[model samples]
Target: MIHDQSMQRRRSRIRGLFGVTAPTDAPADAHTPVEGERARLLDAIRDFLLGNNLDISAANLLAAHTAFSGGNPRLRRRIGERIAAGEAISQFWLDQQLRDDGKSDPATHYEDMAVRLQSSVERFRDTTSSARNAVVSYGRDIASQVETLAREEPAATSLLREKSQGMAETARTFEMRLLRAEREAQSLREELARARRDATIDPLTQLPNRRGFEAVFEEEFRMARSNVEAMCVAFCDIDRFKCINDSFGHDTGDRVIVAVGELLKTMGTGSCHAARHGGEEFVMIFRGFTTEQARERIDAMRIALGKRRFVQESTGDVIGKVSFSAGVADVFAFPDRRNALRAADEALYRAKEAGRDRVEIAG
Candidate 1:
């Protein structure tokens, strides 16, 4: 909703004021001091939120943090390029990137869905409470009328019959209303449950998403600690995935993703835990495996996938061999899981630099 062309006019001021550039764009010794870099990142995040009229909500801020925090180099490059080209960054664009990158949820979709569900629950509670009170009050009225009629007063018998008829009709109407309310509330409850489940799943690969992966990781971490078992975390990324997207289109690219996800998913069917970390990136946790052991397992998957040739379904064009690079780190060797994962990512980068379709183990 924050899309506006006029907002781009301020982008010129941003570039001239803050000399923020990605590592690829800067010279070898162009690194800023750590404090200076931090300040620039903070300023960039604040300016991105305020300048684009984007809300300072969790999604926006998270996207901003990821873009500037060096966690997502591609996102940073994209933002810099857009600003350099005098294009305004919109909320829609940010949300699309979030969906694409797996950094966080898109916009406020989940949060808003949660709020709506909570509101429905409260309304349902109120409706049920009101219906219960009405039933109790009606019961009291009926008892009083019955007691009076038992007094054998013939003078009021006709009036009592008329009042009893009205009460029956009123009770029927109330029951019907309560039944309708119950049905509606039940449907809403089912929808809310689905929404919660959907939030943790990746629609593209039918795999657990980043959030889902974290949940799995936390559980596995506790288990590994208790059992005194060795654990390894691997970062796997498709080699030159953008080239496939450009050559065969996103549909073929998706097939490639599905192929890799399926193989990893099969691994998860066993003791391993696998998830889609983001675009073209998958993470896996292997319990009771050393770094080299995990590397061999991942390399086997890499070789198996590389042996298969893909064809574009529409044009029958050969999409060539698809393979991925992976980096595995022994979780027990690191101080924490986060550091171990970070080391894995760094090793993955080294694997890409050395060659595609290979595996590297973090030392």
Candidate 2:
């Protein structure tokens, strides 16, 4: 009996840690071993994490639970073989994942922390309310006693005056506490908003990273679908990027990427978004633009970049010009975003095959 109780306790603790609910139904046999149930639950959790290509670290596991529970479609769609390959997930990988999802912004974390803090604030408020009520009730009781004392004995009036002075001080303290709570809540909200914006932006190019691009793409795609407007997606890659990196070193290569990003940013308007889609690659979404319009814009950018010269800072040697190739696809042409992206990729391949510095439109 003691062993059974201990096993039950262990199982309960495991369930609590994993955010799993305890079984409501009793076991068929009283002799059923608790180890079996515990192992089963643990195995199931491990399998779920591995299947989803999520890291099995404590933080990641909890994040996985939250993602699954909240039905985060972006994270859901991102699950792939790369994450499921049984490699240890490092902090860098987590950050990369965040960047990919456009969630590199601190805002999401801030929001989560704010939510938890809000709950704590609510509970504290409730407790404060109860305490305030108790104080009021006590004050009322003291007033009644003082009133009785006045009728029975007038000498107790001075003592009642002292108690009233103390009550006033208590009220002031309560008011300060309430004010502090309000300030804290407001501060947390602002911090969360700031975090979100910072997380989505890439420091190198000062542009939205892959995650940010995904967010913009999804929004633009939805808007286009609803309004029946034309939308285009373009994939741009620096031509001979490897050659640049090998010839001039990574620092110069980075400078080229930054320069390209800036140029893309200039081309962006309210209806357009430019993003750094990882190393040497960029993505642009043009709202209310057909494939041809997108192709024109991309070609223009390519030619402009080709005309611009880059000089190596250290040696003062002219590094010559940089160019890029791009593929443009009409969002409405394909059945889904994935298909459209695949088509754009194929077009990009063709552009590379034909020559390095041109734009190709998806058929």
Highest-scoring model, TM-score: 1
Give one digit per residue, the lDDT tens place, for model 2 in 1-363: 986665455444433322344533333443444554445435434544553345668866654443333222224223322333334444566556656544333444454665676667656656665666665676666667767877787787887768766875676677567566656656655675565666667778988876577688888898888988999888888988879889888899999999999999988888898987667778788988989988988888888899999987888788898999888888788656755665666577567667879999988
The TM-score measured for candidate 1 stands at: 0.70
How high is each candidate's TM-score? 0.70, 0.62
- Pick the lDDT winner: 1
Candidate 1 residues lying further than 4 Å off, grouped into runs, are: 1-61, 64-108, 122-126, 133-137, 152-157, 332-335
**Per-residue error at 190 for model 1, in Å?**
1.1
Model 1 per-residue lDDT tens digits across residues 81-196? 56666677888988877676644334235656686776878688578758856875786788587668857787787787787778867876776777677777777777877776
Q: Runs in model 2 with CA error above 4 Å?
A: 1-156
Q: What range of 10 consecutive residues in model 2 has the weakest lDDT sum?
A: 72-81
Q: How far in Å is the alpha carbon of 66 misplaced in model 1?
A: 4.1
